[model samples]
Target: MTAIHDVAIIGGGLVGASLAIALEGSGLDVAMVEAAPAGAMPAVFDERNLSFAEATVNALAALGVMQRLRAPTGAIVRIHASRRGDFGRVLLEAAEHGREAFGQVVVARDFGEALEARLSGVAGLVRHRGTRFTGFGAVGDGCRVLELAGEGPPRMRARLVVAADGATSGVRDALGIGASRHDYGQVLMVARLRAARAPDGTAYERLGDDGPTALLPRGDRAWGLVHGVAAADAEAVKALDETGFLARVQDAFGWRVGRLLSVGPRSAYPAVAVRAAALAATRAVLVGNAAQSIHPVGAQGFNLGLRDALTLAGLLVACARRGGDPGEASLLSAYVARREEDRRRTLEFSDGLARITANPGHAASLLRSAGLVALAALPSLRAGLVGGAMGYRGDVPDACRSGAAR
Candidate 1:
C-alpha cells in the first residue's frame, strides 16, 4: 500500500520549499522530493544576487522569509537604467515609488538558509531531501504513485503533484508536456566582488552593444555583477584569471561604482528564454523555473517563480479548506488564468529588452538608443517602466497577496 499525501512537490529548491512552508497547518499532507543529496543547502553566493522589487519584498514579508533574513543583506533604494551612446535613461527612486526601498538584495544562500530555517517550524511537512523522482503514474482518482531512488518501491502517493523541478524539469518531461526554448546566443557572467565605492543601496543597469551589465547592491560591503557577453567571448571571460576577469569587468562596466577591488570565483551560464507550453494538466502543475526560465537580464526569474508558487499555494489551501480537491482541473485552470498576464508580460519584456540591447547593427542601435532617450524624457513612460521594475500589474499569485495562512 502507498502512503498518501495531500500534495507531492518535486524539487526542493527555493520555490518548492517555500510553498511547502506556506501549506503548513492547513490540514494538508505535503512532501517535497529533491534530486540533490539529503539536507543539501544552497550555496552562499551564486554570482547572482536576488533583486526583490517592492512587490516581491511584500510577498516575501507576507510569507515571513524577509524578517528572518536580518542584516548583512542589502536593500535597493534606487534603480537606474541607461544605454551607452544613447542620450536617454530611466530612474526609479524608492521615494518616487512611495516605498522604503524599491526592493531588498539578498545573497542566494541567505534567502535559502533563512527559508530552510523557517520550514523547520511549519508542521505536517515532510521533506524527502535526497530522494529523486524516478517516475510517477496516475494510480486512481485524486492520487498518483511516485517512484524514488534508493528507497522502497513507489511508496509515495499524493492527490496533487507540483513540479518546481527547475528549467530542465524531468517531471515536466515525464508528464510529456512540451516547451518553447530560445537560446539567446549570449552568455551571462555572474560574480560577487568587493568594490572601492560603497553601493549605498543603488542598483545600476547599463545596456551596451556587448550586452547589459547589472550591478545590484549587496549589503553595504559587496556588490553583485551580471555581465552579458557574446557567446564566443563567454569561455574567454570565464577562463580569465582573477586579475584578468576583474579587468574585463572593469572595462565593460566602467567606473560607475568606482574601481572593483576583488572578485570572487566567476560563474557563467548560457543565456536562454524558455517557457513550458502548459502550466498545468489534470492533476499536476508546474511553478517557478519549471514553467519558464527567463533571461537573468533583470533578476526577475526568481521573483516571477515565487509568484507562481504563491498563486498555486493559495489556490490549493483555499480549496482544501472548503473540502475541494486541490489538484482538480477546476483549481488548476484557475491558477493558469491567474498567471497568464504575468507570464506573458514578463517573458515579452525580458526577451524584447535582450534582443534590442544586444543588437549590434547601426540601425537597431539608433532605434534602441532613441527609444531609451525618449523613455527618459517622458515622465509617464519612465514611471511605467519603473513600475514594472517594482513588480506591478503582472500575473501575481494570491499567496503573494495573502500572508501564508496559519
Candidate 2:
C-alpha cells in the first residue's frame, strides 16, 4: 500500500521548505518534492539578496529556521526613498516605529543552505529531492493522486498538494491554473558592491528616468545592487566593464551610499508581474511565486509568500488537530479568505510603485514628490507605510503573531 502523506509540497524552494518546517511535529505526514538534488542550491539562489520583513523574521524564528542560518545577515534600520529631479525624499526609520530593525537582508544561497540543513531534523517530514511533480488526479472526496517522474508505482496519494514551484510552475500548468502576466519592459541587474563608506543599516531606493535602483545593505561596507535598465538596454548595461557599470549605477543612484568602489558577478532578469487567477483549485493550492510573482519594488515578493506559507501551515495544523481533511472545501475556502486581502494589497502596492516610479511625466513626478514629502511630514501616513512595509497588514497568522509553531 502506498503511504498517503497529509501534505505533499511541490517545489522545495524557500516557501515550500519553510512550510514543511512550520508544520513540524504537527502530527501530519508531510513530503517535500524538489527537482534539485539534496543540499544543492537552485539558480535563483545564486548570489541574490532577499529582504525579509520583521514579521517574516519573527515567523522564521518561530519555526526554528532562523537559528539554523550560518551566514551573517544585514539589518535594515531605515529606508530612504527618493527620485531623480524630485524635490522631496522620505525616510522611514525603525527608531520611529520602536523597533530595532524594520527588516533584514540575507543572501539567497545562505538561506537555501540554512533551509536544507534544517529540513533533515523536522519530525515526520520526508524530503524527496531530485523528484519532479508530473501532475495529479482526483482520487476521492478529499484526496489527490500525485504522479512523479521517476520509478516506483509512478503515483502516490496525498490529502493536500501545495505548489511552490516558482513563477513558471509546472504543477500550476498541469493543474490548468491560468496566470496574468505583465512585462514591465525593464530588466534588473544585480551584483554585489563595495562602497567607500559603510551602509549604516540603511537601504536606499532611487527612482530615475530609466527605472528604480535599490541598494540593500549586505555587510559593513558591502551592498547588494539591484539596478533596473530598459529591456532594450540590458545587453549594453551588462556589456559594460566593471568600472563603467559602477559609474552608470552611481550616476543613477547618486552619492547616497558614497562612491561605489567595486562590483562582483552580475545577474540580470526581466521584471514581470505574474498573478494567478486563483490560489486554490481542487485539492491543490499555490504558494510563493507560483501563485503570484510581482516586481521587487518594495521588496514584498518573498515576504508576502512567506505569509502565504505560514497561513497555510496554520490552517493545516488546525485541520489535523480537529481530524478534518486538509483538502476539504471549507479548508480551502478559509485559506482563500485569509489570504485574499493581503495578496491583493501587496500586489497593488508593488505594481503601483513600479508603475508610478517608472512614469516620467511631469505631473506624475510632481505627485510622487509631493507624496514622498507627505509621507515624511505626516505621521499617520508614515506609520501606515512603515506598518505595511513591516508586514503588518490584514490577518496575522498565529504562527507569525505568536512566534510559535503551534
Candidate 3:
C-alpha cells in the first residue's frame, strides 16, 4: 500500500523547515522534501546576517529553534534611521516600549544549522533531503499525489501540499498561479566588518540617494553591513580590493561606526520584488518566498514569511484537532482571508520605502525629511512604525505573541 501523509511540504528551506517544526506536536503526519544534500546548507542559507523582528524571535523561541543555535546571536536594543544630507532623523529605543530589545540578529548559515538540529529532534516528522518535487500528479480520494525525483518516493500522497519552495516555486507554477515582479535596479552588498566603535546593541540605517546602508550589531563587537549600490556599479564595486571596498562602505555609512578597519568576504544580492497573484490554488497553499518576495529595505522579508508559515500551521493544526481534511477549499480560503491584511501592508511598506529612498529628487528628499521629523515628534507615528517592525501588524500567531513566548 502507498503510504499517505497528512502534509507534504515542498522546498524544506527556512520556511519549510519552520512549518515542519511548528507542526511538531500536532497529530498530522508531516514530510519535508528538500533539494539540498545531507550535511549541506540550503542555497538560501548563505553568509548573510538576518534581522529578526521581536515577534519572529519570540515565535522561534517557542519552536525551540533559538536554543539550538551554536553561534552567538545579537540583540537590537535601539534603531537609528536618517537620511543623508538631511537634518531630520528618527530614533527608537526598546526601553520606551517596555521591552528589553526590539529583536535579534543571526547569520543565515548559523540559523540554518540551528533549524536543522531542531528538526532532527522533532518527533515523527519525516525529512527527505536531496529530493526534488517534480509536479502534482493528481488530486483524488481527498488528497493530492506528488510526483517527485531523488531520494523520496517517486509518488507521494498528502492531504495538503504547502508550496514553501521560494519565489520561483514550481508547485505554484504547476498550480497555474502567476506572480508579478518588479526590478529595483539595485544590488545589495553584505559583509562583516570590524569597526573602531563597538555596535553597542544599536542598529543604524542611513538612506542615501543611490541606496540605503545599514549597520547591524553583532555579538563579537563587530558590525554586519548591508549596503545598496546601483546595478551597473555592482561589478565595479565588487572588483575593489579590501581597503578600497572598506573605503566605499565608510563613505556610504559615515563615521557613526568609526573606521571600518577590516572586512570579510562579501556577497551581492539583486533587489527584486515578487508577489504571487494568489495565495492558494486547488488543495495547495503558498508560504514564505513562494507567496511574496519583497525588498530587504526594512529587513522584513523573512519576518513576513515566517508569519505566513506560522499562521498556516496554526490553522492546519486546528483542523487536525477536529479530524478535518487539511486541504479543503473552504479552509484554504480562510487562510487567504487571514493573511491578506498583513501581507498587503508589509509589501506596500517594503516596496514604497525602497522606491521612496532610491529617488534623489527634491520631492523625495522633502518627503523623507518630513517623515523623519514626524517620527521624531509624534509618539503615535513612532509607535506605529515600531509596531510594524516588531511584527505586530495583524492576525499574529499564538507562538509569536508576548508573555509565554517571551
Candidate 4:
C-alpha cells in the first residue's frame, strides 16, 4: 500500500466502484477513495429507483453484481408511450423484438449493497473509505500526486488518475477540463407508489409540453413515478399532500395502470445536461457523471456512465497484460476515441427527446406526432429507439453487449 499504485480512482460511487470491480484481477495496483463512511447509506440518496437497461444488466450479471442483490428486481417486458392531447402513440413489446425482457429496476440502496459486497473480493486492493480527495498535481515523473484527507495517507502517486466524483467534479476541475451546462428549465419529481392494478411488467411514459411523466414497475409490486414539471411549478407541486399529489399524477398520466393508491416520500432534481469540453488530459480522465450528466427523461444517465467505466477498465486491463503504461497518452487518447460515438449519440438522444417534446411550435408538434405514429405503425422505425433504450447505442464495450462472453 505504500508504493505508488498504477491507478488512483476518486469518488467511489457506482461508477467508480464499477471501474474498481472491473479492474480487480487485472494485475494493476488499484485504490479507491470514497467520502462516505463504510456502510453509511444516505437515506435521501438511496431512495432513488434506477432503470437498468438490458446491456447494463448483462454487464453487471457478468461481474456478479446482479447476483449479489438481496431484493427482487422488476422486469420490463413492454413499453407504452403517448402524449396528452396527441393522436399518435407507441407500444413496444419485448417479445416482438425477440427478447424476453428489456431490463430491470432496482432500488439504489440495494444496488449499492451489491456493489459493496463484490468490491470486498478484489485481492490486495486498497480502500480509502470516508476519505476526501483534495486535488491532484503532476509529480513530474509520469505520475500524479493525489492529496487526500481522512484515514488514508496524505498523498498517493499513480500513473493514471480517474475522476468519478460526479456532475460537479472537483477532480475534473482540478485537471483543467472545462464543462458546458444547459439548464432545461424542468425539475423531475420522483417517488414510489402503488397502483390499484398491479404492474404487468410494462413501463409507461406520458409526454407533455414540459417533459415526460414516467411510471416504472418495481419488484415490490409498486411503481416508480418520475414526474416532470416546469421549474415555475416545482414548489407548488412539491407542497401538495399525498392525496393531491396522487390526483395530479392521475390527471397527467391517465388511467393506463389504474388509480394510484399511495405514495412514499418524493424527491426533486433539476434536469440539466452537462458535457465536458474534453474527455482526457495528461494522465487523467473523467467517467460517469463527471464526464456528462443528462436529463433523466430517457433513463440513459447511469447506463451511459456504466459503459464509460467498462470501456476504460477493459482497455486498462488489456494494456496492463501487455506491460504498457496505463497513464501513457496513447492509452488515454484511445479511451476517449473509443467512447466518442456512444457519448455523442447518447447526448443527442437524451437532449433531443426533451427538446422535441417541450417545443410548443406547431411544426415541432406535428413532427413529434409523426415520429410517434411511425414508431407505432412501422416496426422497423422502432428499432432505433429500442436499441437506444436497450443500451446498444454506439461503440458498446464487449462487457456491456448482450450475451457477451466476458
Best by lDDT: 3
TM-score of each: 0.94, 0.97, 0.98, 0.97
Q: In candidate 3, list every pair of residues with a backbone clash.
A: none
For every model shown, the clashing-pair count is 2, 0, 0, 0
Tens digit of per-residue lDDT, candidate 2, span 54-112: 89988988888777788778999999999988889999989988999998999898888
Q: Candidate 1's residue-wise lDDT over 218-277, tens digit each?
A: 984788888878898887778889888888878877898888899887778888877999
Candidate 4 minimal-lDDT segment of 10 residues: 39-48
lDDT of 3 by residue, 1-406 (tens): 5668899999878899999999988899999989998888898888899999999999999998988889888899999998787779989999999999999989999999999998889999988888999988777998898988997678889989999999999998999999999999999999988888888999999988667899999776778889999999999999999999999988888998788899999999999999999999878999999999999989999999999999999999899999899988888998999899999999999999999988888888888889889899999999999999999988888888853531
Off by over 4 Å in 1: 42-47, 151-153, 398-406
What range of 10 consecutive residues in model 3 has the weakest lDDT sum?
A: 397-406
Backbone clash pairs for candidate 1 read 88-373, 342-395
- Any idea what lDDT model 1 has? 0.80
- Give the whole-model CA lDDT for all candidates, comma-separated: 0.80, 0.88, 0.90, 0.89
| Candidate number achieving the greatest TM-score relative to the actual structure | 3
Q: How well does candidate 4 match the true structure in TM-score terms?
A: 0.97
Candidate 3: lDDT of 241?
A: 98
lDDT of 3: 0.90
